[model samples]
Target: MSKALSKAKGFKQSKSGTYLSMATTAYGVFGVAKQVKKARREHDTLRLLDAAVSAAAIVTGLALLVRELKRLGDDDVLLG
Candidate 1:
Protein backbone atom coordinates (compact mmCIF):
# COMPACT_ATOMS: atom_id res chain seq x y z
CA MET A 1 0.00 0.00 0.00
CA SER A 2 1.03 3.57 -0.52
CA LYS A 3 2.20 5.65 2.44
CA ALA A 4 -0.95 7.74 2.39
CA LEU A 5 -3.18 4.69 2.31
CA SER A 6 -1.32 3.15 5.24
CA LYS A 7 -1.63 6.32 7.25
CA ALA A 8 -5.33 6.53 6.58
CA LYS A 9 -5.90 2.93 7.60
CA GLY A 10 -3.92 3.30 10.82
CA PHE A 11 -5.13 6.69 11.93
CA LYS A 12 -7.91 5.35 14.17
CA GLN A 13 -5.54 2.94 15.91
CA SER A 14 -3.72 5.76 17.65
CA LYS A 15 -4.52 6.94 21.19
CA SER A 16 -5.60 10.35 19.92
CA GLY A 17 -7.75 8.61 17.35
CA THR A 18 -9.50 6.60 20.07
CA TYR A 19 -10.14 9.80 22.05
CA LEU A 20 -11.63 11.37 18.96
CA SER A 21 -13.84 8.35 18.41
CA MET A 22 -15.13 8.56 21.99
CA ALA A 23 -15.82 12.27 21.63
CA THR A 24 -17.68 11.74 18.38
CA THR A 25 -19.76 8.93 19.85
CA ALA A 26 -20.66 11.09 22.85
CA TYR A 27 -21.75 13.82 20.46
CA GLY A 28 -23.86 11.32 18.54
CA VAL A 29 -25.60 10.28 21.76
CA PHE A 30 -26.40 13.92 22.45
CA GLY A 31 -27.84 14.29 18.96
CA VAL A 32 -29.97 11.22 19.50
CA ALA A 33 -31.40 12.78 22.66
CA LYS A 34 -32.39 15.83 20.65
CA GLN A 35 -34.06 13.61 18.06
CA VAL A 36 -35.89 11.71 20.77
CA LYS A 37 -37.19 14.93 22.27
CA LYS A 38 -38.38 16.12 18.86
CA ALA A 39 -40.07 12.81 18.23
CA ARG A 40 -41.87 13.04 21.53
CA ARG A 41 -43.01 16.56 20.77
CA GLU A 42 -44.32 15.52 17.34
CA HIS A 43 -45.86 12.30 18.68
CA ASP A 44 -43.99 10.35 16.01
CA THR A 45 -43.69 6.71 17.02
CA LEU A 46 -41.38 5.75 14.16
CA ARG A 47 -39.04 8.61 14.84
CA LEU A 48 -38.92 7.63 18.50
CA LEU A 49 -37.93 4.08 17.65
CA ASP A 50 -35.33 5.31 15.17
CA ALA A 51 -33.82 7.56 17.78
CA ALA A 52 -33.75 4.73 20.31
CA VAL A 53 -31.87 2.51 17.91
CA SER A 54 -29.40 5.25 17.08
CA ALA A 55 -28.78 5.82 20.80
CA ALA A 56 -28.07 2.14 21.34
CA ALA A 57 -25.60 2.01 18.46
CA ILE A 58 -23.81 5.09 19.72
CA VAL A 59 -23.52 3.59 23.21
CA THR A 60 -22.10 0.42 21.77
CA GLY A 61 -19.52 2.42 19.84
CA LEU A 62 -18.56 4.21 23.04
CA ALA A 63 -18.10 0.89 24.81
CA LEU A 64 -15.81 -0.38 22.12
CA LEU A 65 -13.81 2.84 22.21
CA VAL A 66 -13.37 2.53 25.97
CA ARG A 67 -12.27 -1.09 25.67
CA GLU A 68 -9.68 -0.13 23.09
CA LEU A 69 -8.40 2.65 25.29
CA LYS A 70 -8.19 0.36 28.32
CA ARG A 71 -6.25 -2.22 26.36
CA LEU A 72 -3.83 0.40 25.16
CA GLY A 73 -3.27 1.61 28.71
CA ASP A 74 -3.10 -1.75 30.49
CA ASP A 75 -1.21 -3.82 27.95
CA ASP A 76 0.84 -1.05 26.43
CA VAL A 77 -0.44 -1.96 23.02
CA LEU A 78 1.14 -0.33 20.05
CA LEU A 79 -0.90 2.49 18.56
CA GLY A 80 -0.23 3.40 14.97
Candidate 2:
Protein backbone atom coordinates (compact mmCIF):
# COMPACT_ATOMS: atom_id res chain seq x y z
CA MET A 1 0.00 0.00 0.00
CA SER A 2 2.80 2.39 0.81
CA LYS A 3 4.49 1.64 -2.49
CA ALA A 4 1.29 2.33 -4.36
CA LEU A 5 0.89 5.62 -2.53
CA SER A 6 4.46 6.59 -3.32
CA LYS A 7 4.04 5.88 -7.02
CA ALA A 8 0.81 7.89 -7.06
CA LYS A 9 2.55 10.83 -5.45
CA GLY A 10 5.36 10.82 -7.97
CA PHE A 11 3.16 10.11 -10.98
CA LYS A 12 2.93 13.80 -11.85
CA GLN A 13 6.65 13.89 -12.50
CA SER A 14 6.51 11.03 -14.97
CA LYS A 15 6.67 11.70 -18.70
CA SER A 16 3.09 10.79 -19.59
CA GLY A 17 1.84 12.51 -16.47
CA THR A 18 3.71 15.68 -17.33
CA TYR A 19 2.26 15.61 -20.83
CA LEU A 20 -1.23 15.26 -19.40
CA SER A 21 -0.60 18.22 -17.11
CA MET A 22 0.69 20.32 -19.98
CA ALA A 23 -2.39 19.49 -22.04
CA THR A 24 -4.74 20.51 -19.24
CA THR A 25 -2.79 23.69 -18.59
CA ALA A 26 -3.02 24.56 -22.27
CA TYR A 27 -6.77 24.07 -22.08
CA GLY A 28 -6.85 26.41 -19.11
CA VAL A 29 -5.13 29.04 -21.21
CA PHE A 30 -7.89 28.79 -23.81
CA GLY A 31 -10.49 29.15 -21.09
CA VAL A 32 -8.73 32.21 -19.71
CA ALA A 33 -8.57 33.73 -23.15
CA LYS A 34 -12.31 33.31 -23.49
CA GLN A 35 -12.85 34.94 -20.13
CA VAL A 36 -10.71 37.87 -21.16
CA LYS A 37 -12.73 38.30 -24.31
CA LYS A 38 -16.03 38.15 -22.45
CA ALA A 39 -14.83 40.53 -19.78
CA ARG A 40 -13.72 43.02 -22.38
CA ARG A 41 -17.03 42.74 -24.20
CA GLU A 42 -18.93 43.63 -21.02
CA HIS A 43 -16.38 46.19 -19.79
CA ASP A 44 -15.76 44.22 -16.57
CA THR A 45 -12.45 45.46 -15.21
CA LEU A 46 -12.23 43.08 -12.26
CA ARG A 47 -12.96 40.00 -14.33
CA LEU A 48 -10.43 41.08 -16.90
CA LEU A 49 -7.82 41.50 -14.23
CA ASP A 50 -8.65 38.09 -12.79
CA ALA A 51 -8.33 36.45 -16.20
CA ALA A 52 -5.00 38.15 -16.79
CA VAL A 53 -3.64 36.85 -13.50
CA SER A 54 -4.89 33.35 -14.19
CA ALA A 55 -3.33 33.42 -17.65
CA ALA A 56 0.03 34.40 -16.21
CA ALA A 57 -0.06 31.57 -13.69
CA ILE A 58 -1.01 29.03 -16.33
CA VAL A 59 1.82 30.19 -18.58
CA THR A 60 4.28 29.82 -15.73
CA GLY A 61 3.02 26.33 -14.95
CA LEU A 62 3.35 25.31 -18.61
CA ALA A 63 6.89 26.65 -18.69
CA LEU A 64 7.82 24.58 -15.64
CA LEU A 65 6.28 21.45 -17.10
CA VAL A 66 8.10 21.94 -20.39
CA ARG A 67 11.37 22.32 -18.55
CA GLU A 68 10.69 19.14 -16.61
CA LEU A 69 9.87 17.26 -19.81
CA LYS A 70 13.10 18.43 -21.38
CA ARG A 71 15.04 17.32 -18.35
CA LEU A 72 13.40 13.92 -18.49
CA GLY A 73 14.32 13.57 -22.14
CA ASP A 74 17.92 14.44 -21.39
CA ASP A 75 18.04 11.91 -18.59
CA ASP A 76 17.04 9.05 -20.87
CA VAL A 77 20.15 6.83 -20.76
CA LEU A 78 18.77 4.29 -23.26
CA LEU A 79 19.05 6.74 -26.17
CA GLY A 80 22.80 7.08 -25.84
Candidate 3:
Protein backbone atom coordinates (compact mmCIF):
# COMPACT_ATOMS: atom_id res chain seq x y z
CA MET A 1 0.00 0.00 0.00
CA SER A 2 2.73 2.45 0.97
CA LYS A 3 4.74 1.50 -2.09
CA ALA A 4 1.77 2.12 -4.33
CA LEU A 5 1.20 5.52 -2.76
CA SER A 6 4.83 6.45 -3.23
CA LYS A 7 4.75 5.37 -6.84
CA ALA A 8 1.66 7.44 -7.46
CA LYS A 9 3.23 10.49 -5.91
CA GLY A 10 6.36 10.07 -7.99
CA PHE A 11 4.33 9.70 -11.13
CA LYS A 12 2.38 12.84 -10.36
CA GLN A 13 5.57 14.77 -9.77
CA SER A 14 7.07 13.58 -13.01
CA LYS A 15 3.92 14.51 -14.93
CA SER A 16 3.82 17.95 -13.34
CA GLY A 17 7.43 18.59 -14.26
CA THR A 18 6.76 17.70 -17.86
CA TYR A 19 3.64 19.87 -17.93
CA LEU A 20 5.54 22.88 -16.58
CA SER A 21 8.30 22.47 -19.13
CA MET A 22 5.78 22.24 -21.94
CA ALA A 23 4.00 25.35 -20.72
CA THR A 24 7.27 27.24 -20.70
CA THR A 25 8.03 26.12 -24.23
CA ALA A 26 4.59 27.22 -25.35
CA TYR A 27 5.09 30.64 -23.83
CA GLY A 28 8.41 31.00 -25.57
CA VAL A 29 6.77 30.19 -28.87
CA PHE A 30 4.00 32.68 -28.23
CA GLY A 31 6.54 35.38 -27.41
CA VAL A 32 8.31 34.74 -30.68
CA ALA A 33 5.07 34.97 -32.57
CA LYS A 34 4.25 38.32 -30.98
CA GLN A 35 7.70 39.65 -31.81
CA VAL A 36 7.34 38.56 -35.38
CA LYS A 37 4.08 40.43 -35.72
CA LYS A 38 5.56 43.55 -34.19
CA ALA A 39 8.60 43.39 -36.44
CA ARG A 40 6.38 43.08 -39.47
CA ARG A 41 4.66 46.28 -38.50
CA GLU A 42 7.99 48.09 -37.92
CA HIS A 43 11.54 47.28 -39.06
CA ASP A 44 12.93 44.67 -41.50
CA THR A 45 16.17 44.12 -39.57
CA LEU A 46 14.30 43.53 -36.31
CA ARG A 47 12.00 41.15 -38.14
CA LEU A 48 14.97 39.07 -39.24
CA LEU A 49 16.32 39.07 -35.72
CA ASP A 50 13.01 37.95 -34.36
CA ALA A 51 12.81 35.15 -36.90
CA ALA A 52 16.27 33.94 -35.98
CA VAL A 53 15.56 34.09 -32.28
CA SER A 54 12.26 32.25 -32.73
CA ALA A 55 13.92 29.50 -34.77
CA ALA A 56 16.63 29.03 -32.16
CA ALA A 57 14.10 28.88 -29.32
CA ILE A 58 11.99 26.30 -31.12
CA VAL A 59 15.01 24.11 -31.91
CA THR A 60 16.34 24.32 -28.38
CA GLY A 61 12.97 23.57 -26.85
CA LEU A 62 12.44 20.55 -29.10
CA ALA A 63 15.89 19.19 -28.26
CA LEU A 64 15.33 19.63 -24.56
CA LEU A 65 11.91 17.99 -24.73
CA VAL A 66 13.30 15.05 -26.71
CA ARG A 67 16.13 14.58 -24.25
CA GLU A 68 13.74 14.65 -21.33
CA LEU A 69 11.42 12.16 -23.03
CA LYS A 70 14.32 9.80 -23.70
CA ARG A 71 15.41 10.08 -20.10
CA LEU A 72 11.90 9.35 -18.94
CA GLY A 73 11.73 6.30 -21.19
CA ASP A 74 14.99 4.99 -19.79
CA ASP A 75 13.76 5.61 -16.26
CA ASP A 76 10.55 3.71 -16.92
CA VAL A 77 12.50 0.76 -18.30
CA LEU A 78 14.73 0.74 -15.26
CA LEU A 79 11.78 0.94 -12.91
CA GLY A 80 9.95 -1.82 -14.66
Candidate 4:
Protein backbone atom coordinates (compact mmCIF):
# COMPACT_ATOMS: atom_id res chain seq x y z
CA MET A 1 0.00 0.00 0.00
CA SER A 2 2.74 2.47 0.86
CA LYS A 3 4.68 1.52 -2.20
CA ALA A 4 1.63 2.03 -4.38
CA LEU A 5 1.03 5.41 -2.83
CA SER A 6 4.62 6.46 -3.47
CA LYS A 7 4.37 5.53 -7.15
CA ALA A 8 1.08 7.35 -7.58
CA LYS A 9 2.51 10.54 -6.14
CA GLY A 10 5.65 10.37 -8.21
CA PHE A 11 3.75 9.65 -11.42
CA LYS A 12 1.43 12.54 -10.82
CA GLN A 13 4.39 14.83 -10.19
CA SER A 14 6.22 13.72 -13.33
CA LYS A 15 3.23 14.26 -15.60
CA SER A 16 2.21 17.60 -14.17
CA GLY A 17 5.77 18.83 -13.83
CA THR A 18 6.70 18.13 -17.45
CA TYR A 19 3.58 19.80 -18.80
CA LEU A 20 4.20 22.80 -16.60
CA SER A 21 7.80 22.99 -17.72
CA MET A 22 6.75 22.89 -21.37
CA ALA A 23 4.37 25.77 -20.95
CA THR A 24 6.87 27.77 -18.93
CA THR A 25 9.70 27.15 -21.37
CA ALA A 26 7.54 28.15 -24.30
CA TYR A 27 6.51 31.44 -22.76
CA GLY A 28 9.99 32.09 -21.40
CA VAL A 29 11.64 31.61 -24.77
CA PHE A 30 9.14 33.87 -26.41
CA GLY A 31 9.81 36.57 -23.86
CA VAL A 32 13.55 36.13 -24.15
CA ALA A 33 13.41 36.38 -27.93
CA LYS A 34 11.45 39.56 -27.71
CA GLN A 35 13.92 40.99 -25.25
CA VAL A 36 16.88 40.00 -27.37
CA LYS A 37 15.31 41.49 -30.47
CA LYS A 38 14.64 44.73 -28.73
CA ALA A 39 18.16 44.86 -27.39
CA ARG A 40 19.59 44.12 -30.80
CA ARG A 41 17.48 46.77 -32.48
CA GLU A 42 18.75 49.25 -29.92
CA HIS A 43 22.33 48.03 -30.43
CA ASP A 44 22.61 47.15 -26.74
CA THR A 45 25.14 44.34 -26.57
CA LEU A 46 25.03 44.08 -22.79
CA ARG A 47 21.29 43.48 -22.64
CA LEU A 48 21.46 41.02 -25.50
CA LEU A 49 24.06 38.98 -23.63
CA ASP A 50 22.00 39.20 -20.49
CA ALA A 51 18.97 37.83 -22.29
CA ALA A 52 21.02 34.99 -23.68
CA VAL A 53 22.39 34.15 -20.27
CA SER A 54 18.92 34.12 -18.71
CA ALA A 55 17.55 31.88 -21.45
CA ALA A 56 20.41 29.45 -21.03
CA ALA A 57 19.84 29.34 -17.29
CA ILE A 58 16.17 28.57 -17.80
CA VAL A 59 17.02 25.69 -20.14
CA THR A 60 19.55 24.31 -17.68
CA GLY A 61 17.03 24.37 -14.84
CA LEU A 62 14.43 22.57 -16.94
CA ALA A 63 16.98 19.96 -17.94
CA LEU A 64 17.76 19.30 -14.30
CA LEU A 65 14.07 18.98 -13.45
CA VAL A 66 13.49 16.48 -16.25
CA ARG A 67 16.54 14.55 -15.20
CA GLU A 68 15.21 14.31 -11.68
CA LEU A 69 11.84 13.09 -12.96
CA LYS A 70 13.56 10.45 -15.06
CA ARG A 71 15.61 9.34 -12.08
CA LEU A 72 12.42 8.96 -10.06
CA GLY A 73 11.00 6.52 -12.64
CA ASP A 74 7.46 6.77 -11.38
CA ASP A 75 5.62 6.37 -14.66
CA ASP A 76 4.08 2.88 -14.67
CA VAL A 77 2.99 3.15 -18.28
CA LEU A 78 6.51 4.06 -19.22
CA LEU A 79 8.00 1.35 -17.02
CA GLY A 80 5.67 -1.28 -18.46
Residue 26's lDDT within candidate 4 is 61
The clash numbers for all candidates, in the given order, read 0, 0, 0, 0
Q: List the residue pairs that clash in candidate 4.
A: none
The top-ranked prediction according to lDDT is 2
Candidate 4: list runs displaced more than 4 Å.
1-12, 75-80
Cα lDDT, all candidates:
0.83, 0.85, 0.68, 0.74
RMSD score of candidate 2 (Å):
3.8
Candidate 3, residue 24: how far the Cα is off, in Å? 1.8
Rank order by lDDT, top first? 2, 1, 4, 3
My TM-score estimates for the predictions, one after another, are 0.75, 0.74, 0.59, 0.66
TM-score, candidate number 3: 0.59
lDDT of 1 by residue, 1-80 (tens): 98777767766776777898899889887789899999999999999999999988988999999999887774332332
| Candidate 3 whole-model C-alpha lDDT, 0 to 1 | 0.68
Residue 33: error of model 3 in Å? 0.8
Q: Which portions of model 2 miss their true places by more than 4 Å?
A: 1-10, 74-80
Count of clashes in candidate 2:
0
Q: Write the per-residue lDDT of candidate 2 for residues 1-80, one digit (tens) a residue.
A: 67677777767767777889999999997889899999999999999999999999998999999999998885433222
